[model samples]
Target: MYSISIITVGMNHLAYLKSLLHSLYIENHPKCSFEMIYIDNCSKDDSVKFIRENYPEVKIIENKQPLGFGENNNKGVFASTGKYIAIINPDIVIQKDSLDILLDYAEQHLQAGIIVPQLLNPDHSIQYSVRGFISIKTLTARILSKGKDNVNNKTVNEYLCKDLDFQKTQFVDWAIGAAFFMHRDTFAKLGGFDLDYFLYMEDEDMCLRCWKNNMPVIYCPQSTMIHNHLRGSSKLGKKAWLHIQSIITFFRKHGIKIKNSKEHTMSL
Candidate 1:
């Protein structure tokens, strides 16, 4: 069996997908033995053809109908034969030793629910991928802070985990779904992502479940990757509507609790 299974879903992300695939394969970024799985979400572009032609070794799961992020990842996990599985984005470029670092940490902290590396922008600035468990109050304050520059963005800052030191490795509430790692057993135990979240908020729900189950969410700064973040939630119509719907579903499943990140921290 492979040491790690890297899964990524793409919908017309041909350019980004090429960079990611090249970095993983041609550059041989991962140190451990791995199986690559790419889920094509009914792309209108020639993404499937390119993968089949350029990287035949990569297992491709093509969909007739577009699927959600969580569903695509679950499908990849179902097809994987690795001890560890990473559900990442097509826009992320992996480092040679990134997976090995996370694997070493996972070996030591076997109970970790989700482990994520530091995500950097193209210019090498840190992305706010790590965050505390988002509460309704924090969400409301973030919306309110959009227009006012002088307003204290403390609530939003805390929600993004800016209150904590970003340089040090620590247990956090959650990380973005762009790059999430977990053992196959842990994923099976958690039942994977909740189907209730069709688009967004699935990552947060999974991490919240992890915390509820006393499993730590590890943030390893030493393992860094570059992510070309496409902020779909910031879009005007459909994406925004989906985000709102997911938020409602999340709150329905688990009530809007306003606990801090310190409360969720484990002995790790």
Candidate 2:
């Protein structure tokens, strides 16, 4: 039987976390055994206590100090004992048998090191999770566009791969970190996520490494999940700054340089 470890990092989003947990419990898949692991990032909302009291089956790890996204996930992975580790966000609600579908697809495509499900909005609209490699022009366009629908722009179109049909499963350059499933051995081979990243772009970095190691990063549209995505970084303040910093770090590590653009660019 296949085994999976569902790992999720929590902050102060208690209500969403509870909803996610309920969704997981209700979604049934008899083919595989799974365990839930929650890593609390020292949330002030008593999230750790709530989980322990209500969901005793879930293994909880309380972080004394808040850690970055990659570091918290790594800690969860270390505590997992499943063949596959699923890194999921607190705000995501899993669909019925979604985990089984992803696991089945991953088993069939043994060469794929990482697999991502089709992410849907609460309104049932498709969320474009798969994306192309980030370039200076693409980054500029995304920042300028500010998360609006501007696929008409050439750079934004290419960056978002607007030409591709997301209804079909295919190999992708990378997908969002909102949900990621990887083989234990493959994840270990990549040395987990690079700790240099604080919160953003770590998904892209890991997918890049997967390609370098000759492992395909797959996008599976068969399985779906609803993501309560709040583009927190796009709003303003420290989150936006952290997002920019991660972008710089990713580009620097990959030897890609961002040039100043005089023309107005669109956001993604």
Candidate 3:
């Protein structure tokens, strides 16, 4: 039996955080085989105090200085002592037996470096959480239709091969960072998420690194979790700015030059 460490980065989401902790407590997993770490990234609310009083079992890392997603998660990663590390968001709730399926998949597929479970919206609708590569066109389309509706919904299914008859686990270019699981050794090999990305696109950067190492990022629909993804860089104003900055940084760091609706410079 392999031990697992669950890491979550949160700030000011006390209500959702409590629900998340409670879900974990009732989740049908062997408690002796896993541990949870919450990194409070200088939250202005009473999240720290709340965790301290209620969830004493969770090891809380109080960040005196504010840290971004990648940095704060890295803090939790360093503190974890599990063979596999699960990067989860505070708003996601793992369904009963979800961890069992994920662990079983990981054990069966040794070549797969990173794994993502099927992500569902709050209403139990199938959310295409996996993605292909990113380009300027994708970025621009997403920017053009920011708050009104999901631009990705139009092309996400085809991109993720959801339209095909393939229902089994398959390799993917990238998986959303909302909920990701990978071996501790693989995380060390890839150096974890790049700290340069303050918030968005860190998952893409990490996926690119895993691809370079000839490791596959897999999507297993057998195991599913409801991801309340209405947080962070998806909000109205500041989220857009952070997203654009991260896009530009992602291209520059990966040497991908945008052309006519295509970024052909990147190898994978």
- Best candidate, TM-score-wise? 1
lDDT of each: 0.85, 0.84, 0.77
Give lDDT tens digits, candidate 1, residues 45-82: 89999999999999999998988889989999999999
Identify the superior model by lDDT, candidate 2 or candidate 3.
2
Cα error, residue 246 of model 1, in Å, equals 0.5
Considering TM-score, which of the candidate structures 1 and 2 is the better prediction for this target? 1
Candidate 2 whole-model C-alpha lDDT, 0 to 1: 0.84
Candidates ranked by TM-score, best first? 1, 2, 3
Model 2 spans > 4 angstroms off: 27-31, 149-151, 257-268
TM-score of each: 0.95, 0.92, 0.87
Of the candidates numbered 1 and 3, which has the greater lDDT value?
1
Positional deviation of residue 200's Cα in model 2 after best superposition, in angstroms = 0.2
Per-residue lDDT tens digits for candidate 2, residues 103-162, read 998787787778999999899988777788888777788778885655567888876777
lDDT tens readout by residue for model 3, 1-268:
3378999989887878877887777655544378889999888889989888987888999888888899989989999998888998988887877776777788878777888888888899777677767766555555566533344565433445456323567667787898888889899999988998888889988987887776778778888888887655665678768877998899998766422102223221
Per-prediction tally of clashes: 0, 5, 0
What is the lDDT for 228 in model 1? Answer: 95
